[model samples]
Target chain A: MLTVKHLAKSYNGTKKSLTDVSFSVSPGEVTVIIGPSGAGKTTILRSINQLIRDDDGEILFDDVDMRQLNRRQLRDARSHIGMIFQNYNLIEPLTALENVLHGCLGTKSNLAGMFSLYRNSEKTEALQLLQKVGLGDFAYQQCRNLSGGQKQRVGIARALMQHPKIILCDEPIASLDPKSTTVVMDLLRDLATNDGISVLINLHQVDIARTYADHVIGINNGQVVFDDRTAALTDTAVTDIYRKTTSSERSLVYEG
Target chain B: MIKPENQVSLPTQLPAGPRFTIPLRFRDRRRVTMLITLLILGYVTLITLPTMIPDHFKLVEAITGFTENIKIMFLQPHLSNTSWLSLLGGLGQSILLAFLTTLIGSVLAFFLALASTRRFAPTALVLGIQSFMAVIRAIPTVLWVLIYSVVFGLGANAAVIGITFHSVAYLTKVYADSMDELSPEAIETLQAMGLKRPAIICQALIPYLKPSYLSWTFIRFEINFADAVAIGAAAGAGGIGYQLFMSSSFYFDFHEVGVMVYLILAFAVVLEIISYRLRSSNTAQH
Candidate 1:
């Protein structure tokens, strides 16, 4: 389980990205965060894993405060938390398998990773994750050669390589095509069901949020406006959450 | 005047400033500056040239040392050394010195560069390491070599020490710049997956810097070839430079001197070609 309390982050000292924002993730729940741009959705997820330090907050992962953890302890804790990026941040020079092996950082010694002398046990595990993401055949291919959707699949597999308790996805499908977008969303959905892993995904699409998320949390202007089951969000409330200020106030998306 | 393309293009009228005050002369400044500099240099040389005539006169005796007819101005026709070991042995020593020094200095500079980069290290440590690197690079390699030669005593090792010291300075600068421009997103991706600083530095940064590093090392070897020539001149050490200096001092041996000059140029050109190949392959691999 993961808990974030009073989390606040700001690039400039004056402005707060997240103001007293709090959230918790159960062991097997998939929590989808929806927000307009600059609404501090990504910041909230990054802050939880201490990738970006929160100005004032406490993040507890597996009953240990993440902020209080030293470098090694933090690294250890981070291994249980995997993060995915919209850009598919795979190391370009490495093959897909090697890039996935990068997720074993907390589990491996500093010397082992530095020398790349560690056994292919983690590598084999990474390949299995790749197979789960449907990249089973392209393990040895360079990441640069992978298409956008394939790269994200690799990114997802890389995150999974950590055997993480939770996964953080920051617009993982924003830059993807429609088909690929559906694929990634479905994959995340399956990950939750099959592995019993918690996920915090940041997305802007209301329909996608409604379709894939178990529960949806909406943020507008850096504050959460909606927190409830996905089925309970009405058309009017969804528009309000999205801040689509149409003079006609017509629904932007058709709901069948 | 340009109705079609200009009208359709985005509006980008030049902003008024000191950036280009002279509109007609704004193509480039280098041409005009280079002309002025050359004129000034030429005039200075003309004025001070009489004082240098005596030095050229000394070369006349060195030129006349060859007994053969064509060898007078053509330089030494043969690599005739006073001692076979000194010539062959010195050639071997020169190569060995250049090779060893390049290896040592390049390795040391590489690690130091990695340590000093902000991207690869924490800011506090990077700043201190960066300043020290700058200080080392500030002093010319010749001075470092000269001082090191004095301290370490006059031998090939001293020359190597000097070469490595200077190599560290330049290698550090180049490696630091490369490391700074290393793909941050790439490194972060690795880190996000739980990779450490060293892993990212090696897998991501080191490979990117490889061609540049190898090119730099080859360049240093070429420089140190001439540098080794000059080093022996300073310390009366073992090298072709000592032979040239001593040979020219007693009797004018333009033939042997030409041989020395030719040898240096030949080796340097070969190394330069190899460096070019390295840069090309570096691009290919990456």
Candidate 2:
């Protein structure tokens, strides 16, 4: 389980990007955060992994405060937490299987990592993960050759190789086609239901979020406007979340 | 006029056009001034050219003398002091010197680049190393060889050290720039995966930068070859360049010099072909 409390952030001491944001994600469930563009949805997801350090906040994951950990401890903590990006941030020059093997880089020694000395079991496991993501044939293909959907699937396999307790996805399907969107979403849903891993996603598509998310958190102007079960997010609630800022309200600074 | 079914109604009143305080004609005055200054400089240089020549210099006679030398050099090319086999050996020595310098330089540059790139090191360290490299790069490679010769006493050792020093600085800047071109997203992904710095560099950075590194190192090799040839004569480091120097100056053999020039040209063309192949293969992979 992941719990964020009183999350506050300001870039370069300018206007606030996130204001006292707090939320909890339960295991065995898909929690989707829906917001308008520049609503700090990316900020919230990145904060959980401490990718961009939050100014003031308590990010507690499995009773360990993520913010308080030292460099080494933070790395150890991060190894169990998987992250997926909209761009499918696999090393484009590497083969799919080689990229998947990189998931265990944090666990390897410096010398072993430098030499790329992966054991037979690790290679087999990476191949199996690729198969699981329906990319068994593309395991040896360079990621730059893969289509957008295939690349995202490769990313999913890479995250799974971490054996993550919670997977944080920031707009994973934003660049994907409709067919690929359904495929990626269904895979994330399966990971939650079958694997019992907590999946937290930031999305712009309300209908898709409604379809896959067990719990929905609606954000407006960096604050959580609605946090409830998916069934409780009515049409009006989504409208409130995505409402455009008026000319006067627009003067209030916001960073995308 | 009937509206298209899908077309929306246009706005009744469009906003005003963007306003500027300065007049349009005066806005580009700075450019006009720069052009005028360049024209004046050109006129001055053209007027002063003849006056700058020495009193003893005779243009027609000098041209005739130069053509005579060129005619003898190209039309009657032959080895005088050194045999053909020895010339080949000298060429081999220069090639080896260039290859050895490039190898050592690239290896050292790779590590220094890792430290100089912004994503890896602190701001202070990055700035320090970059500025230091800038100073090293500012000095000419031949000048560096001369400087090192003062200590190493003008031999292959001094030439190697000087050439390698310059190569490292040059490669470091190019390598770092190539490293900078890497997608920040990839680095973030690796860091988020809890991969330490060394692992990140080895697993992700190295593989991504491999093609670029190869191309840049080959470019440096070409440069080092030219530098080695130059320093061979300048620093008393024996190579085909020294042979060319000895034949042309001491023995006054223009034919031997012409032969050496042709040999160098052949080798240069071969290097260019190899470099082209490397570039095409790299792009194909991409």
Candidate 3:
């Protein structure tokens, strides 16, 4: 489980990227954040991982404040919090198996990781994860040669390699096609239900979010405009969430 | 269905005096600048050519003498007078000098590059190392060798030390540039995975830089090889270059000069082949 309370972030000390965002994710649940571009969907995910430190508020992982942890403690905590990116963010020159094996770097000793002295058990698990993500035959294939879908599959396997409690994805299917998008979304949902791993995803596609998410949080202008069970989310509410509004119009409007 | 009043009119054609206009403000200036540069270079060459070759007949005579000397040197080489053992030994020494300097220089440069890269180090440290390398590279390798010879005394040691110094500076700049070309995302992702800086570099950055590093090292080795040869004679550093210098300047043995020249050329060509093979094989593996 993960809990973020009153989180706020501003890049230039001016316009806020995230404002007073609060959310919680339960185990074996898939929570999707839907927003238009620059609405701080990715920012919220990054702040939880401390990739971009939030200006205010606490991120609690199973009731422990991550902000209060020392460097060593934070690193240990982060090892269990896996993250996937829109670009896959794989080491391109490395093979699919090797990229998955990299997930063990934080857990392994520095010297062991440097020399790739991973134990046989670790390698087996990495391979299994790859197989689970449908990349068993392409284990030795370089990530550079992989298609967008394959690369994202490898990304999922890599995140699973950490045996993470919570997995955060920043538009994991943004660059993927419609078919691949369904496969990846399905994979994430299966991981949540079967593996009991909490999944938090940022997505721009409302239809995909509605299709995949158990709970959906709609964000606009750095604020959470709507939050409800996917089934309870009305078509009118969805339209209102994504409706184009200028700064002048925002001054005339208020949220209850 | 019958909403004729609500139908929108779309314009089919544009009203224009000129369909397209060329923006020539910058283009015309660039052309004029290039033309002026060419004209000045041509004029300078014209004025300097006569001074460069004071007499045409002397130039012709010198060329004929050079060709005749080459013919006599290669066709009727004084093989008996040349010592094969010493010549080979000198060649070996020159190669060893190149190898040692490149090895030492590349190792040193690798560390300096890591420290100097903005992605790895603080801004002040990066700027300081970069400026320091720039200063080292501004002075020619020969000048660096000469400076070292003054400090360490004239010998192969001085040549090796000086060449290594220049090589390090050269490689630092190149290696840093290559490292800078790596995508920040790779490192950031690793960092987010809780990897330490060192682990991230080993797992992400080094693999990306390996091919470029090898190519740069090989290129620097070739340069150091040439520098070793030059310094051998210029600083009395005892190598094939010294023998070549002696044969040409003191012994006036053009045949031996031709032999040495051919030997050096053959060595360079072989090195080129080896480098090409290495680069190609590396790319193929990747």
Candidate 4:
């Protein structure tokens, strides 16, 4: 379980990227955040992982405040929180197996990690995760040679390698085709249900969000405008969240 | 039916204009600029022609003599003064000097490059190391060799030191550039996975940089080989270059010069083949 309260951030001293954002993700639940572009959906996910520090917030993971931890403690805490990106972000030159095994770097000794001396047990687990993600045959294949869907599978296996309690996904399927999108979304859902891992995903596609998410949070203009269960979300409410503003409407009227 | 409001009266007489007018002089700027440039070049050549060639007949005679000498040198090569074994031995020494210098220099450069990369080191340290390498690269390789020769007394050791010094500087710049171009996404992902700085660099950065490192090292080796040949003559380092210098300057044997030139060309071609094979093999593995 994870909780974020009163999270606020501003790139400059004036304009806010996220204003008073708060949310919680329960275990084994998929919480999807949907918004138009530049609506601060990614800012919330990045803030939770401490990739981008918030000027005001308390991100409590199992009752420990991430903001209060020092550098070493922060690193230790981050091992329990996994993250996936839109780009797959797999090391291109490394094989899928090695990339998965890289998840163990945080736990291994500095010298051992530098030499890539993964224990047999860790190697076994990494291979099993690869197999679970349907990349067992491509374990030795370099990531650069993999297709987009296959690469995202490797990314999933790599995240699972951390044995994380919570996983943050930032537009994991944004670059994928419709077919690959379904596969990745289905995989994420299955992992959350079977492994009991909490997932906080930032998505732009409202239809996919409504289908997969148990809870949906809609954001607009750096504010959470809608938060409810998927069943309770109306088509009208979704439309309003993504509607173009009135200033543009007025300009159109003037041109006409 | 035609609309009454839209209808207009037509002009009876055609507009008076010249049948054939001169074309616009400055319609296209590029053509005009080129013509002006050609005019200036021709004027300059005409002004300088008399000064450049005061005696055309004497110049023609000198060129003819030079051609005759070249024909004699290549058609009839003399290999009597130096034995084949000594010439081969000198060639081997030059290659060894290049190899040793490149080996030591690349090792030093790898570490210095790691330190100089912005991803690994802080701004102040990276700037400092980069500035130092720039200074080293600014000086010519032969000048560095001459300086070392004065210190160590002319020999192969001086040549090796000089080439290594310049090689380290050259390789550092190239290696640092490749490292700088490394994608930040992989590094960010690793950091998110809780990897420490060193682990991230070793796991993510170094493996990505391996191919570029090898290619850069090979290129630097080629440069160092050329430097070795120059230093061999300048510093009195015993190599094929020294033999070539002696044949041309001391013995005045153009035929021996021809043999030395061919030997050097053969070695250079062999090195090119080796470098090409290595780079291709590396790419295939990746």
lDDT of 1 at B215: 80
Best by TM-score: 2
RMSD of each: 9.0, 8.7, 8.1, 5.7
**Candidate 4 lDDT tens digits, B1-286:** 7799888979998778987778867478898899999999999999998788766559778899898879767777769689999999988888888899999999899889889998788999999999999999999988898899889989887888989999999998998899899988888888888889889878988889898888888888788878887788888888988988788899888888888778888888997998899889878876
Docking quality class, candidate 1: acceptable
True-contact fraction for model 2? 0.75
Give the top-scoring candidate (lDDT): 2
Task: Give the Cα error of residue B282 in candidate 2, in Å.
Answer: 1.1
lDDT of 3 by residue, B158-181 (tens): 898899999999999999999888
Q: For model 1, how does the per-residue alpha-carbon lDDT over B1-286 read when each residue is reduced to its tens digit?
A: 8778567765588767778457676557899899999999999999999887775476656566434535642543455556655765666667777778778888888888878887867888788877887887788766777788778887666788887887777778777888787768777666655666777676667655666777877888777777777877676657777777766665566666666667667777888788888888877765
Please rank every candidate by lDDT, starting with the best. 2, 3, 4, 1
Interface RMSD list for the candidates: 2.0, 0.9, 1.3, 1.2
Hey, what RMSD does candidate 1 come out at?
A: 9.0
lDDT of 1 by residue, A157-248 (tens): 88888888899999999999999998998999988988898988999888898888887888765566788888887797777777943434
The sequence of per-residue lDDT tens digits that candidate 3 reaches over residues A104-221 is 8888788976788888999999999999999999999989889999999999998988889999999999999989998999999999999899999999888888888999999887
Error of 3 at A120 (Å): 1.7
Task: Give the docking tier of candidate 2.
Answer: medium
lDDT of 4 at A167: 89
Model 1 alpha-carbon drift over 4 Å, by segment: A244-256, B1-76, B82-89, B120-125, B244-251
Which digits, one per residue and each the tens of the lDDT, describe model 2 over residues B1-286?
6569968889998789867576666548789899999999999999999899999999899999999999888887888788999999999999999999999999999999999998888989889999999999999999999999999998899999999999999999999999889878888899999998888888889889999999999999999999999999999888988898898888898989989988998999999999999999999998
Worst 10 residues of 4 chain A by lDDT: A247-256
